[model samples]
Structures are given as C-alpha cells and as structure tokens.
Target chain A: MGFLEALNYPIYVAIFICVYSFLAIGLNVQWGYAGLFNAGVAGFFAVGAYTSAILTSPDVPGRLGGFGLPFIAGVAGAMLLSALVALPIGKICLRFRGDYLAIVTIGVAEAIRIFARSEEWITGSSRGIQNLPRPFGDLPYVYSQLAYLALVAAILLVVYLLVERQSASPWGRMMRAIRDNEVAAMAMGKDVPFRRLQAFVFGAALMGLGGALYAHLGRSITPEAIDPMIASFLIWIMVILGGSGNNRGVLAGVTIVWIIWTASEFVTDQLPMEYALQAKYGRIFLIGLMLQLVLRFRPNGIFPEFRPTQKDSRKPDKSDKA
Target chain B: MLDFINFYVVPGIVTGSIYAFAAIGITLVFSIMRHAHLAHGDMATMGAYIALAASTMLGLPVYFALLLAIPLTAALAVGTDKLFYEHLRKKPKILTTMSTLGTALMLRSIVQVVWGVGTTSYAKGITRPNDWFGLKIKTNELITLLALAVVVLGLAAFLNRTRWGKAMRAMSDNRDLALLCGIDNARVITLTWLIVGGLCAISGFFLGINTEIKSMMGWNIILPAFAGAILGGIGRIEGALVGGLMIGLVEELSVLFIPTEYKAVSAFAILLLVLLVRPRGLFNGKII
Candidate 1:
C-alpha cells in the first residue's frame, strides 16, 4: 500500500512539473530573450483555462458558454484568447521600458481577476465553471493520470523543441541584441517595440496553453484555481533561478522548486490542526525568503547564459586598439 | 445637492486622503530611490498590524498606536532596504521593483502567519455621522481630512524650505550631482524611508479607522495608490496628492454608472489613459 502511494505521489508531482515547465519556458522567452517583465502569468493562465473550460464543458443553464468544442480546438482557443489579451497591453506598454510593463501587466491581471469574479454570465461567479473534459476519462484512475501525464509531456517536448529552435534563429539573436542594447539595435534599424510585442504575445500564448492543460487535468476552472500571488510568482522564481536564458536550466529550476515547494507543503500538512494554517503561511514566507537569497547569491542562477566561441580572441584586433 | 455631498464627496475626500498619503510615500521612494516601491502597500499593512498590536497589547489609544507604529515601521523599512534593496542600487532600477514584489509577498505572509486571515477593527462598534450645515460626516473622516491637510502642507514646506528636504530634492533631481555637491546619499535614503514609513503608517491607521483591517487590504489599495501616483506624476508630491483625490472621487462616482465590483476598472482605465496620453503626468513630472 505504501509503495503504491509513493508511486502515485511522484506521478502527480511529475504532472505539475510538466505544467510549470511550460510557464517557465514562456517566461524565458519574455524575460530571458526579450527582456520583458511580465508579472501577470496567472492572468494569461486564467484566460487559457477559462477559454478551454468554456469551450469544452457542456451547457449549464444561464451561462454564456458551453460550446462543446473538441479538445484541440479548446486548447487552440485558449492560446488565441491569451494572445488577444496580450496584444493591447503589449502595444500600450512595450513602448516604454520594462518598469511600466511590470506594473501594467499586474494591473491587467487584476482587471482580469475582477472580471472573472464579477461576470457571472461568463465565469459562473463564485461557483466557477465545472465539468471540463478530461482525456482518457474511461480508464482506471492511475492509468488515466498516467495517460494525461504522457500527453502533457509530449506537449512540453514540442514546445521545448520549438522554443529551442527559435532561440537559435536570427530572430532570437535580434531579440537579445535589442534587450542588451536598444540604441545599437535601433541603429541597425530594428523596431524594438514591435519585436517585444511579438515575444510578449507569443510567450503569453504558451502560458495560456499551460493553463488549458491544467484546466483539463483538474476538470474545472475557478477564480481560486490560480492564486495570482503564489502561482504567478512561483513561475517567476523558476525562470529566474533556472538561469533565464538557458532552457535546460529552466526545466531543472522548475523540478527543484516544485519539489521544495511540495515537500514543504507536505510537512506543513502534517502539522497539528491549529498550526496548519499558520504553517501554510509560513511556507509562503519561506518561498519569498528563498527568492531574496537566490537574487543576492546567484543573480545569474545555476546555469548562466552560454556564449559562442570566437577564434580571434587570442590577438587584439583593430577595433580593440581603437 | 446635499445628498450628493454627503454620499459621494465626503466619502470620496476621505478615501482620497488615504490614497494621497500612501501615494506620497510611493512618489517619494520613486523620486529619491529611483525605483517603484512595490511593497509600499504591504508595508502599510505591516504598519496597521503594528498599530493593532500596540492598541491590543499595550492598551494605547488608536491615535497613539498610530504614532508608535511610525518609528517601528520606519526601522523595519530601513532594515529591509539595507538588506534587500540597497545592494541592488547599482543594478537597473527596475530590478529593484521586481525584488519589492517579493518583499510584498514576504511582508503579507508574515502578517498572515501572525494575525491570521480574518478582519478586525481598531475600535469596535459603529459611529453615526454628525450633521453640520446639512453635511453629514463621521468624526474619523473629519480628522482624516484635517490630518491630511496638515501633513501635505508641512511636507510642502519641508520640501521647499528645510535643509534635509532640499537635499532630498537635490538627490531626486540628479543623484550624481547631489553626491558631487557633498550631500550624504546614505543619510538621504534613510531619511526618505523614515518619512515614507511614517506616512504609510498614517494612511494605514486611517484606513483601519474608516474600515475594518484585513490582511488583503494592503494588496487591494496598491493599484489605486499606483494610479494616483501616476496620475499626478510619479515624482511630484503635489501632483500625487491631487491625482489621488481625483482617483478617489472618480472611483466613488463610478459606482453611479457601473457595478461596484468594477470600481477597480476605473483606476486601471485612468492609469492606461495617463500612460498613453501623458506619460509624464499632469504636473509634468520628471520623465525618468
């Protein structure tokens, strides 16, 4: 019995790791490559979750949704809606530096939360949209979970390959160049704001896809499904701690942080009845403390950005002398 | 007309005063430290908690608790800056803002662990508003407005006339020039945090007095405070004050046309409009 439970536990953790890896990869594009600070990961995630939930879930009376669309269409809808939300926000704030983007994204996230909570016609108010379709629903519990896990892993692999290829392409180099030196990129005649917007919308779509996957896994979407402060901030920590520009580092970071987070949660759950709530909050406090420590001690994270080799560095060139 | 003043204008001014007070701290930090103090609202929650501790544990009056909270919160604010933010001063200012978001979560979690996630008031029981010249106002609301007026006036005088305030302004104007002119950068930063902490306490205390205190109150107020700061101009104190009041009025008046649940949308709309139309703000604040 204990062996069965242990096997199930790691499987659950693995599923979550896959979901969070998608978010961290999305953030890697925005922050690592494009130098955009998106504080509203939860917002895009919610949009995706809701879009998929509304599309796939059967009709509930008095609600605006219940399209009964196919699962693929739902996922696509999630990504498309998330990008649609990102477009206006990126257009308005991408013209400025990252500071404005940070605050505006936060505000936009709050606005989305407000709309979800208040717009009962769409979000079903406090009761939330339910009965979302799950893949492999007819199988045994463990097998169903395993099947969903495999599906998510396959999606993560595809996203990972696509992002990796993009990062190696000329567009990725131009993004990094713009991030490092906007004036130099501008002198080269690149439109900085437009490129940043593309990355922003693209990254948001990935986050939305992550959300859709999570919604389908849970078979529900609610205002409380994603805690903006905790869920969104956790993804930020993953990307930052993993080494922002390195995709492998992001995957590693997600696994480590998720383990630590869940391990702490397990310990807190073991506490006596009265202290459980306090312990839960204490765990939150520690997550925050960890962020500060990592920022101070390992600002470049475990795996710093990898630079390509240049053969001519053994001798001083004319430009060096000048 | 009387009903309008009693219902909307009075409450608007009271709420606006709270925003103005908080925005002052935000603007001061932005101007002097060159970063958005994203933890500003959570710090206010800390102050309110400190005051709650003072009142409950020591049996101090609510106003006295506010006074006690100022110095304590200032010390804490200074400590956080030295530990978390001071090192980041050499980095891009925006990174400091990011760290402050972490700080906000940390501060709020600390509050939650200690106080739990329940609402409480400084002094219990309802107090009915008094009528004067056909205008109804709560005594706390009256005191809030008066205190705001005095603080704003005193702050303006200090900025324009006092030596330390002038030094702060000099730093805000140009950090390198201020250092070259022999102003103490460390002293100015500490002083700014001190004032910011105190103002944060005042605003938090007033908010607690007017409404119940809760762990999430600070988070809820942050966007409005940011809206006010941006509306008035980021670095300009007077602009922040005016902008805060305007936001307060607009938020209250918005209830007339829209659902009360959508009140925050108005503040966000204001923020976007300001960002798009006049990023420098109404007072033509420093572009930086």
Candidate 2:
C-alpha cells in the first residue's frame, strides 16, 4: 500500500480510538472515579447505534426518518436514548454492589441483544440495517471519512472539556467520596444512590455516542456486530490502561489498545494459516493479555494511581455512627 | 390432563433440571467468592469439548466419557482459581467480577484453541433414543437428567454432612466470621471451584448431547443459568437446583406459544424481574 493507503489503516483505527476514548472517559468517571463496574457498556452502545441507524436509515419511514438532520442530531439522539435506557438500568443496578451489579449489567446487555434479535421492527434483526446516512452526502469518501472523524473528534473534545470541568467540580468530589466509602457518604447526606446512578447513566450515554459513530463508519448494523466480549472488555482495558480516573490516561489507553488491536489485525495476516485462524478469534486474547499484565504489575494502571484527595481522606468516619 | 402432564409439566421440569445444573455451579461460585464468575459458561464449554474428545477420539463409552470430564473440568476450575482468583481476593469485589470477564475471554480462547472453531456432535450410537414409559427420551438426555438428580443428591449430602460443606455455608453467610473461626478459606474456595466445575461439566456434556458442542454453546444459555441461580437465591445450592429446572422448563415450553428463536427470553425476563422485584432472589436468600 502507498503512503496515504498505509495512513488509511492508522486513521481508521484512530477513528475507533477517538470514539472509544470518549467511552473510556465516561467509564473512568464511573468505575475509576466512583467505583461502579459496568459490564453492559455494549448494550448502551448498541442502543445508540440502532437509534441513529433507525432515525437516519432511508428505509425507515415516520418515527425518525426524512428530516435529514445533521450527524450531531443522531449523536444527541444516541446519547439521549442510551441515557434513557440507562436510567432504569441504573435504578436496578445502583442498588447492588460487587458481583450482583456485574451479572445484572451483563444480563441487561444480553437481554437487549435478545430483544434486538427478536423484535425485528426496531432493529432489522439478524439481517441488520444498512446504508446509514453520512453527515455530508455531497462530499467524497475521503472527505466524508475525514469529516466523520472530525465530527467524532469534536464530540470527544466537547465531552472531555465538560467531564474535565465536572471532575474539577464539587459533584466530582462527592462522587469520589461515595465510591471510597458509601456508608460515610450516605451518612454525610450525599444522596449516594442518585450520584451513583448519575455516574452510571452518564457513562452509558457516552457508550451510546461511540456506538452511533461506529455504526456510521461500518455502514451496517447487525446483532452479530454486537459482541459483548469485545464491546465491554476493550473499554475496561482502555479505562484501566489509561488510568481509570484520569481522562488523559484513558485517552492514552484507548489509543494504545486500538493501535495494538489494529496492528494485531495486520500482523495476523502475515502469520501462517493455522496461527492466523487462531488469532482471528475476536479481540479476546489481546484484551486478556493486557488485563493480566496490568493487574500483575501496574494495578493502579499506566497513568497514575487514583488516590482520594487529602481533604476527602481526612474526613471523619461518620458512617460508623449509622 | 395428558397435555399438562406430557406436554407442559414434564418438559418444563426436564429443561428446568438442565438449568439447575448450571445454577448449581453459578451459585457456589458467587456464594463462596462473592463475585459472579463470568467464565462459568466457558468452563462448561471446555468440559463439553473434553467429553466430546474423549467419547469420539478414545472410543470410550459416552457414560465413561462424561465421568472422565467431571474430574478433568474440576481440576481446570481449581487451577483457574489458584492462578487468577486467589490474587484477586484482596481487591474490590466489582473489579474481580470484571476480572472474571478477562478470565472468561481467556478460557474461551483456550477452548477455541484446543478444539478448533467449529461445532462437535456426540456420536450417533451414543445419542440413540431409549424408551422410558413411552416418553421417547434420548438415551443421552435421560442419562444427563439422572446424573443431575444423583449429583444434586450427592451435593446435598456433602453439604449437610461434611465439614467442608458446613464451612462453605458459614463462609457464604459471613466471610469474616468464617475466617475468624479458623475455617480454611483456601479449602472452601477450592471446594467451591470443585463443585462449580463438576456441575458445569455435566451441564456442558448434556448440552452437547442434547444440542451440539460449540465454544459459545454454554454461554448461549448463561442468562437462564443466571436466572436459575439468582432465582434460587445466591448462596443456596438447592435453590440453584430448583431455579435451573424452573428456568429450563420455562424456556423449553415457551416454544409452544412463541417462536423457538425467542427461547432465551424466559431466562432474561425472569432474571430481570427477580433482580428488580425480589432483589434477594426468589427464595429471598433462604438457605436450605
């Protein structure tokens, strides 16, 4: 491949990174900052993707089609739809901690997948929906690619800015308190459940946004495309490798993981037939290797360890009274 | 009367029994370790593949093949706990739950690696039909159902009568007290893996015999298994048994009114409803 074509691969991979990094930031906000591990990011991701596809697909009438809204509208719809779903999911999930929440989220994602498969009216079922509308129809493929990239990048930047500002805010501080010590936070009247739900719902919305972008890029949507293994684990890996609580670390993690993922895709093509077939099994091996290494050596992750601030750490054990 | 007895009730119980097999392992792992073992499906998958290899390659009788798989799968589970989970004991519970996902991925890859990426079927001779009261049961299915009953009885006896079982129960109720009382956490954890792996292997074998052996086969019904365990209450082994059978029956019988494609609907629906309305599970965490 020539230079631009070679550049094509990295850029395509970067597209996934930029979108994924947005999600990692949200997850960092939830699990890294507030300690809510959500294994159902895939569900929200699918919700967002399908939302945009259904709204913008040429085939679908009424409901959401024909307005010819900008890509931004689809992005907004994705976030809103996903967040809407997450509200109820969050309600149920926020009540449980530890494994209960983990399994419940996985169940929710699978349930969504099953519904998506069963309800052919909403999603196109196993056949999937195709020909998703791009942001600028008049533009060429390369410009469209670049425009879409720019669009996602712009959204990522906006989210990063907003989340950054929030993290620096009082709400962020209280979220950390709740995560570090739920009982103490509850005693202090921090609205522990509400805060947890907010973090989870918000993070899930970002997952939706990423999914919408991914659907546009691939130009097709299918239940087969929605594998929870890759969708959930890869994001966790990114958030961890990047430093769960740190946005910058998450950005780095997404970039590195996506690159590694892309490179593996290329490198496997060069391997012998059997080895190639072995490597073809979806991104599980790479994701596992990263988690194993991260857990073994750098449990805190590649960025810095997320530590409670001195102010928060010094707070009294008010929860003990309860 | 015949429809209720022949069509509805018996089928529900049979499928529910299959689900119970899965629930047993899931409940044990969750109760003892306090994390949802996402790798449970893959362990079942691995076991099914092992049994497939044994029965087909070695020319062993399928019954002996299944018997061989139970111990082999249990050993794998113990090794998995020692390697991955033991270290995770000190970490936060949710993190470990996410970590089991990594283990799940790793295990599936290993399954795909050892047994190529295709489906394997039990030999026809072994899977042939056997008449039991004119019910037209497959020899494989009946053997699986009976094995499940025997295993359930065996496990109940072990838990009620043995030191390890009592310790496991105490640990599930309160880990801190169990630890303080000089209960060996390591042994209970190891034994937890042992039971989970054993039943998971049996679940996998019958699944292969009833359907087919594929990497994702165990996971396909995982939600139902989750339904079974949680419905039975997390720590209660008997709850898992009943829960699984109930879930299986519901799933199988739903096909009468709905498309077979929507079969997994019961598992997720029951799971979501139970989680929402009865957060403690159907049995309300009732220890049997």
Candidate 3:
C-alpha cells in the first residue's frame, strides 16, 4: 500500500480521533469540571446517533423521518434531545457522590443499550438502519467520508471553543468551585447541586453531538456502535490521559489514543498471538494497557490542564488512596 | 396446583439463594473498597474455571477442586488488587471507578483470549433433579440453597465472632476511625477480599453449573449482582445475602408474566426504582 492507500486508514483514524475527542471533552466536562461520575455516556451517545439516523434515514415512516433534515438540524436535534434526557439523569445522579453515582450511571447506560436492542420500531432493533442520507450523497468522486470528516471537525472545533469559553464563565467557575469544595461553594451561596446538574446536562449534550457526528461518518446506525463499555471506558481513558481539566490537553489525549487504537487494529496481524483471538482483542488490550499506565503514573493525565491562576483544578479532589 | 407452588416457588428460592451468594462478594468489596470490582462476576467465572482446570482436568475429586479454587481465587483477588486497583487509590472515586471499568474490560479480554471467548461447562455433569417433600429441585439447585445458607451463616458467625471479621466491620463502618482504633486496615481489607473471593467462587460454580458456562456469563449478571448488593445496603453482608435472594426470586418468578428475555430487567428495574426512591437502600446503611 502506497501513500494514498495508507493515507485513507490514517485519515479515517483522524476522523475517529476528531469525533472521540469531542466525546472525551464531553466527559471531561461532566467528570473533570463537575464532580459527576457519569458512567452512562454511551447512553447519550446512542441517543445522538439514533436521533440523527432516525431523522435522516428513509426507512421509518410514522415517527420523525422523511424530512431529510439538513445535517445541522439533525445535529442540533441530537444535542437538544441529549440535553433533555440529561436533565433528569443529571438531577438524579447529582445527589450521589463517587461509587454510588458510577454504579447508577453504568446501569442507566446498560439499560439504554438493552432498550435500544429491544425497541425494534424506532431503532430498527438489531438489523440497524443503514444508508442514512448524507447532505451530498449523490455527488460523484466526492470523497464523501472526507467531506463528513470535515463537517464533523468543524462542529467539534466550535464545541471546543464554546466549552473553553463556558469553562471560563461564571457558571463554569461555579462548577469548578462546587467540584473543588462543595461545602464552601454552598457557603458562597452557590446552588452546588444545581451547578453540577447544569454541568452534567452540558457535558451530556456534547456527548450527543459527538455521537451524531460519528453515526453520520460511519454511514450507518447500529446498536453495537454504542456499547456502554466503548462509550464509558474509552471516554474515561481519554479524559484521564489527556489533562482532564485542560482543553488542549484533552485534544492531545484523544488524538494520541485514537491513533494508537486505530493503528494497533491495523497492525494486529503482525502480533505474535493466535491470529483469530488477538485480532479481536487487539484494540481492547491496547486501550486497557494505556489506561492502567496513565492512571499509575499521571493520574492527572499527560498534559495537566492549564489552571487559570485564579481557579483551582476542577478534577475530583483526592478521595480514596489505593 | 399445589405441585406448581412447590416446584416454582421452592425452586425460585433456591435460585435466589445462588444470586444472593454471588451478590455477597460484590457487596462486601463494594462497601469496603468504595469502588465496585467490575470483574466480580468474572471473579466468580474465574473461580468456576479454576475449579474445572484444577479438579476435573487434573483428575482431582470435586471437593479437592473446590478446595484449590477457594485459595487460588483468594490469591487472585489479592493480585488483582495489587496489580490493577492499587494504582487507583486516592484518585477521585470517579476516576478509580473508571479504572475498575478498565480493569473489567481488561479482565474480560484476558478471559476471552485465554478461554477462546466461548462458554465452558463443568466436566462433572449434573446428574438429576429430585423431589424433596413434593418439591422438585435439581441437585445443583439444592446445593445452591445449602451453600447459600451455610455461607450466610458462616459469614454471620465470622463477622460476629472473629477478631479479623470484626476489624473488617470496623473498617466498613469508617476507614479513618478503624485505622485510628489500631486496626490494621490494610490487612483487614485483604482478608475481606479473600473471603469474598472464596464465596464468590462458589457462586460462580453454581451459576455455570445451573446454566451454560461462558466467559461473559459473569459480566452479563453484573447489573443484577450490583442490584442485589445495593438493595441489601451496600456494605452490610446480611443485607447482600437478603438482597440477592430477593433479586433472584423476583427474576425467576417474574418469568411467568414477562417474556423470559425481560426477566433480566427485573433486577435493573428494581435497581433504578430503588436508587430513585431510596438512595440509602433497603437496609438504610449508615443512616439508620
């Protein structure tokens, strides 16, 4: 494979990095900025993916379909719907701290996956809805995937800038205040739980946006794409490995990890193991190893987020010592 | 009609006992460690698999296999703690929780890679179902009930009697206070994992024997197992024992009204509703 052939895979990986980076940022918002240990990111991601697919796909008749809504509308729809679902989940989970919240969110995401698997009418169950219309589906030699990649990148860039701006805003500062010292924040007359809820909802909406972008890029919608493990574990690793509180750190983390993931997947055949088994697990092992190493050495992640001189790190205050 | 009650309800109790057995390990570790061992189900599976590898494969007797698996799983739990979870200490609870998430994924992959990602059954095939006092129950199911009763009783005695068990209780009550009281908190924590590992193995054996054995078998039941743990009051062993039984009975008896597939959701439904309505859990935990 020459440059062009090799380039396609990496280019595709770039797109994945772009999408997952936003997903990580979304998680970084919920977890890093707010003390919400949301393990159900995959649920919001699926919500975004399914919403986009359902609205754009030609298959379903009765519900929201056949409009061929513009990509922007579909993306916005996913964001709105995700925020809607997040409102209650955020409120509910905001009350619990640490392990209790983790268990609940993981269960919630799994339940969502189960619901997705069972609800055939809306999501088409296991068969999945494919050939979801792209904005320029019929244009010849369009490098359609490349175009989708550009579109996703643009959305991600906007989200990144917006999150950066908001993280510096009064509300964002209040979010960090609650995360750092809830008692003090409450003493300062900040509605601590309410602030956390806002962060949760905002973070979840970002996840929804990433999910919608990913679904369109993949050119198909399937329940399997949104495994809770994939949504939660990978996003957690990204935020942790990339400086969780740092926006730039998050970008570096997402890019580096996704590149390794996609690249390892490509090169697994050369690995010295049972070809059949190793190929399947190659991706998981790589990510798992990196997660362990990062947690061990740089629990704060690779690039420590630049703490604004006035603000403290919004990361979870030291809790349990291993 | 009377026969149906004996067959279903009685059998339901037996099945519930097994779930309760499994839930005990999860609850113990969850309460103590403050983060769940996502691989609790897999620990059970690993125990069952260890029993198979040691006893049946090596030509050891059934009891001998279990004897080996008990200690081995206990050791494995310690190793897992040191290797994976140890790195996550003092990090945010959420971050440590994610580490367990990573650990679960890693352990699952290791199980799949080692065992070929397929279901493996016990070599000693279960022989027969029996009619005891007009109630039809499989021998394995009977064993499940007996094991649950014995384990629960044994755990109660251990917690109430032994110095180490009491130390564990102290730690569970409050880690900082436990340390302040001159309790070797680390040693107590390790012992807790050991006991949990052994008991969890038995639960694993029963689970695989009752159904098909697969690597994902434990992972699949994780949600329900968590359900049992939470329902029982997160840290209380007695609570876990009761909660597991309740979840299991609800799941089994629920099949009559629901499609069997939906039976799995019963525990989660209980989990969600419980968390929503009663966050402190059925036992009231620290509050009461």
Candidate 4:
C-alpha cells in the first residue's frame, strides 16, 4: 500500500481506538472501581447502535426507523436505551457475587444477538440498516474520516473528564469501599447493592455511547458487524491490562491493544489463501495467551491504580490548621 | 400423550443425560475448584472432534473412536488444568473463570482451524430407530442413557466407597480442614480434573452422536450445561443430573411455543429464573 493508503488505515484504526476507549473506560468503572463483572459489553454496545439507528435513520418502507433525529439526539437515545437495559439486570445480579453478573451478562448478550438476527423489523435481519449519516459525510473521504476522528476525540475527552471527576468524588470512594469490602461497607450503613447498580448502569451507558459512535462511523448496523465474544474479550483485556482503576491507563491500553489487534488482522490477511483462515484462529490463540501472560506476570497491570498515600490523607486541612 | 412421551420426553431424557453428565462434571469442579469451568463445553467439543479424527483417519468404528477419544480428551483436560489453571489457583477463583472464557475461545478456534468451520458427521448413512414396543429409539440414544447411568453410579460409588474419592469429597466439603487432616490437595485436584474431563468427553461424544459436529456446537452447549449445573444445584452431582434433564426437556418442548431459532434462549431463561428464585438451586447447593 502507498503512504497515503497506509495513512488511511491508521486513521481508521485510530477511530476504532477512540470508540473502544469509551468501552474500556466504561468497563473500568464497573470492573475496576465497583468490582462488577460484565461479560456482555457487546450487548450494551449493540443496544446503543441499534437504538441510534432506529432513532436517526431515514424512513424505511418495512422496518422501524425514519425518526430523522440529529446525531446528538441519537447519541443521547443510545445511552438512555443502554442504561435502561442495564437497569433490571444490574439490580438483580448486583445482589450476589460478581460471578453471577458474569453469567447473566453473557446470557443477556447472547439474547441480544439472537434478537438482532431474528427481529427483521428492528435490525433489518441480515442485510442490516444502512445510510447512517456521518457528521462530515458530504466532504471527501479522507476529510470525512479525519472529521469523524476529531468528533470521537472530543466525545472521549468529555467522557474522560466526567469519569475522572466521578472517580475522585465521594461516590468513587464509596464504590471502591463497597468493592474492597462489602460487608464492612454494609456495616457502616452503605447501600452496597444500590451503589454497585449505579456503577454498572453508568458503565453500560458509556459502552452504549461507544457503540453509537461506531455505528455513525460505519454508516450502518448489523448483527454480525461485531463478533460478540471477541469484542467483549478484547475490552476485558484492555481494562485489565491498562490498570483497571486508571482512566489514562485504560485509554493507553485501548490504543496499544487495538493497534496490535488491527495489525495482526493486516498480517493475517496477507497469508496464502489456505493458511489465511487458520491464521485468523492463530491470532485468537495468541490473544488468549496474552491474557494468561498478563494475569500471571503483572496482575496489577502497567499503570496500577494510584492509591493515594495514607500519610497524605491523614494531614489536617489548611483551614482546620488555621 | 403417547406421542409426546415417545417424541419429546425420550429425546429430552437423552439430551438431558448429556447435559446432566456435563453438569455433574461442572458441579464437581465448582464444588472443589470453586469456579465455573466455562471451557467445559469446549472440552466436550474437543472430545467429539477427536472422536471424529479417530474414526475418519484411523478407520475405526464410530463407537470405538468414541472410546478412544475418552482417554485422550481426559488427558487433555488434565493438561489444560496443569498448564493454564494450576498457577491461577491462588488468585480469586473469578479470575480463573475469566481465563477459561479466553481458553474457551482458544480451544474453539483451534478446533475450527484443525477441522475447518464446515459441519461434519461421523457416519454418512442415517440409522433407523428401533421400535421397542412402540417407543422408537436409536441404539446410540440407548447407549447414551446407559452410559450416563453408569457414570453417575460409578462417581457416587467412587465418592462413597473409595479412598481417593473420599479425599475429593473432603476437599470439596472443606478444603482447609482436608489439608489440616493431611489430605493431598494437589492430588485431589488432579483427580477432579480427570473425572471432570472424562465426563466432558462422554457428554461431548453423545452430543455429537445425536447432532452434527460443528465448531460452534460447544459454545451452544455451554449455557444449557451451566443451567443444568446451577439448577440441579452447583455442587450436587445428582442435582445437576436432574437439572440437566429439566433444561433438556424444556429446550425440546419449548419449540411448541416459540420459534425453533430461539431454542437456545430457553436455557438462559431457565438459568435466570433459577438464579432469581432459588440461587442455591433445588438441592441447596453451595452458595459460592
């Protein structure tokens, strides 16, 4: 490929990285801070994608759509729909151990997938919904992509600031406390399950936003557009490898993992015809191996969550000293 | 009623036997090792594929190939435990569960790569069902039911009557106490994997015998098998057997109400219902 063509590939990947960063950040809130396990990240994502598609896509003859809402309205609808789905599941599963949540989430995701494939009126069956309007779609290809990238980055910045601020606030501290020791938190009269449910819903909403961004970029939505297991697994690896509790680390992790993931896809596509299929599987095997290595060698991840020093917290405030 | 008995109930029982067989293994592993073996279904898939290889390449009869696959799959299961899970035993059991999800993907991918993605069957010609006084049944179905009975009885016998089985039971009941009493935790774990692996092979083999062997078969079974385990009670072998059969029956009978394509949803629905109503399961399984 020529330099400009190669540049095009990286720009596309960069857009995905931004999209996945939103997912990883969402997962960080759930798994990292609240110690909730959501194995169905793709479910919330699909909900967001389809919700936006239904809300914003122009009128179709047979299927549900043609709301013709603006892009921002679609994004809001995506987040709301995702959180709505998360609400009941989080309320029920958060009462038990995280493992229950994991299983339920997996089930929920699978159900979403089956529904997407079967509900023709919703997802348009196999053909999928198309002609999703992009922000700068009328511009030349390269400029449109760059514009999308800028738009994604702007959204990511706002999400990052909000999440960081939340994690620093009393709410984050309460979540961490609940996760670290639920019994102790309960003893202190904290509503453990409710707090956990909040984190779970909020995180799922962020994942929905990521999905909306993805749908707008691709200009379409399909049941098979994303491999549920692989997408969910990749997000898990990003959160775990990036330092679950750190947003910066999550963003970094998403960039690194997405690059490696897409780079491997490029390499696998280059193989001879017969071996190419096997190469796809070989890549999955390597990703699994990567998880093992990370868990064993560096369970804490690259940038472990920065637990504020005990001594610093103990110091009296300047106003109190005065 | 007779038609229902012949068509749905018998098939459900056969299918349930497989699920129960797999769930027994899952329950055992959950009780002892303390995590859902998400790869259990995949391991069963591996077993089925190995049998296919043995039959296709070695020119063995399908039954003989299944017999051959049993030991091979068991050994592989043990090896997986040693290679992947042995180290993570110290960490939270939940982390081990996560690794198994990855392992499940890797195992399924390996199967797809080695066998290719297309569906395949062991023997080309279809076998007619043998009518036994009006209840039509296939020989393989009969064999599956028999094997499930034998395996469950043997496991119960082993746990109650044998030394090592007692050690395993002790470990499951109370690991620290078992250790304090001088039980070999490592040995029990290895033995646990052996039985679990062997059972996984049987379930997978039976599933393949009844259905076509496809790369995605294992993934499809994971939810139902887990549902069976949890429904029967996570740590109760007999409970899992019952639960597995219930799920199998519900799945088959569900077609009467819903579209066939949504069959897989039955298992998840059963699982969610059980989790909601009686998380400890019918037999009062360990709550962990």
- Could you report the Cα RMSD, in angstroms, for every candidate shown? 3.2, 4.3, 3.7, 4.6
Task: Give residue A281's lDDT in candidate 2 (0 to 100).
Answer: 75
Model 2 chain B is weakest, by summed lDDT over 10 consecutive residues, at B125-134
Clashing residue pairs found in predicted model 1? none
Q: Superposing every Cα of model 3 onto the true structure, what RMSD results? A: 3.7
Q: Model 4, B1-288: lDDT tens per residue?
A: 778988888888888888898889889988999887888888999999999999999999998998899888889888988888889998778888888887887888899889988988887889998998889899989999889889988988999999999999899899999999999999999989988888888888899998789888877888888899889887887899899999999998998899987998999999888888898899999877
CA deviation > 4 Å runs, candidate 2: A1-6, A60-67, A305-322, B1-9, B125-134, B286-288
How high is the TM-score of chain A in model 2?
A: 0.89
Candidate achieving higher lDDT, 2 or 4: 4
- Point out the worst 10-residue segment of candidate 3 chain B by lDDT: B279-288
Q: What TM-score does prediction 4 earn? A: 0.95
Which one wins on TM-score? 1
Among these predicted structures, which one has the highest DockQ?
1
Chain A: TM-score in each candidate?
0.94, 0.89, 0.89, 0.94
Q: Candidate 4, residues A102-214: lDDT per residue as tens digits? A: 88898899999898898888889788889888899998787788889999999999999999999999999999999888899999999888889999999999999999999
The DockQ score of candidate 1 comes to 0.67
For candidate 3, write residues B64-161 as lDDT tens digits: 78788889988988877788776566765556666666666776677666666677677545566676676677776777777778888999899889
How well is each residue in A179-282 modelled by candidate 2, as lDDT tens digits? 88999999998888889989988888888888888888887789987788668788888888777778888899888887887788888898899788887774
The CAPRI classification for model 2 reads as: medium
Ranking by lDDT: 1, 4, 2, 3
Which ranges of candidate 3 are over 4 A from the true structure? Answer: A1-6, A60-67, A270-274, A308-322, B2-11, B124-127
lDDT of predicted model 3: 0.77
What tier of docking accuracy does candidate 3 attain? medium
